[model samples]
Target: MQRFLPLIIVLVLVGVFLRMMTLEGRNPNEIKSVLIGKPVPEFTLPGLLEEEADLTNAYFNREEPVLVNFFASWCVPCRAEHENLMKLAQEHGVTIVGVAYKDRHADALEFLDELGNPFSRTALDRNGRLAIDFGVTGVPETFVVDADGIITYRHWGPVVGDGLEKAILPALEEAR
Candidate 1:
């Protein structure tokens, strides 16, 4: 019994060490970028306006560069970023698409109405499948896809006021 006690203690210590190492090395903020310089993933979701609006076909047409933003009514950061999106739509001629991540259609509509709808089109990702395809970890993630349908830049977390002028606009210009 004494010999086994020592072995158990050693095993527990090793487990603790491993867990500590993993926690120290892993960064929650360090989200990996995907589809960079590649064609964006093809997906179809319901538009926010209609129960059956075809978002997939509309997105695939290369009329202009597209900004796809993953957001939810429940996300505070999304509300924080909403104004920036609205400004981009109104001022910059930038087409913005919203994906209502894991949210109900009615709630998403209410959020848009309350915040001012900036999105040229809003897609319903009721199950988060499209969000997963886009490598979204959480709400308020944004992706910029060029007119040629290539994904150029991805921003994790909320798109702050400065982020639009600094990062998003430049990428859109380059893609154009």
Candidate 2:
């Protein structure tokens, strides 16, 4: 029995590790952010629209929580999430700030025109500097920022189906 004790402990450790990997709401592809519970990184990006002012970290200084979405005109998942974004802004009156990551202004404009512009302010991250600061790994990533400019939640993929109700709405309420 003493000789078998080591093998039993090893098996228990392996089982625990595997259980963690398969935990609910844990996605193998998700890249966890280091910025959660921290203030948003300071950034200044040109507005996607020529007539609009530049978007800066100061835009997040508000009395309400804001959704910061990283998207691209070329990303198909971004299109899929557009409807939820619009619903959040229009129906729920959630303020959203869009960062167009590594996309041309014209293409972004066309994409918004085709779907509908949900962003109260849209900025261009043409060089991906802002996205990098935000620790964005891909298109359609979103961060929920509280009134104090701290990141409360991060959604790694397109906000579709249950993502809006289950995750985003709850995060927003918590931020409030």
lDDT value, candidate 2, whole model = 0.94
Q: Evaluated with lDDT, which candidate comes out highest? A: 2
Q: Could you report the Cα RMSD, in angstroms, for every candidate shown?
A: 5.6, 2.0
The TM-score leader among the candidates is 2
In candidate 2, what residue range of length 10 has the lowest lDDT sum?
25-34
Where in model 1 is the C-alpha error above 4 Å? 1-28
lDDT of 1 by residue, 2-49 (tens): 979989999999998878668964545657675688787777776789
lDDT of 2 by residue, 7-59 (tens): 99999999999998999978988989999999989988999988889999998
**Per-model CA lDDT versus the true structure:** 0.85, 0.94
Screening candidate 2 with a backbone cut-off below 3 angstroms (N, C-alpha, C), the clashing residue pairs are none
Cα lDDT for residue 58, candidate 1: 40
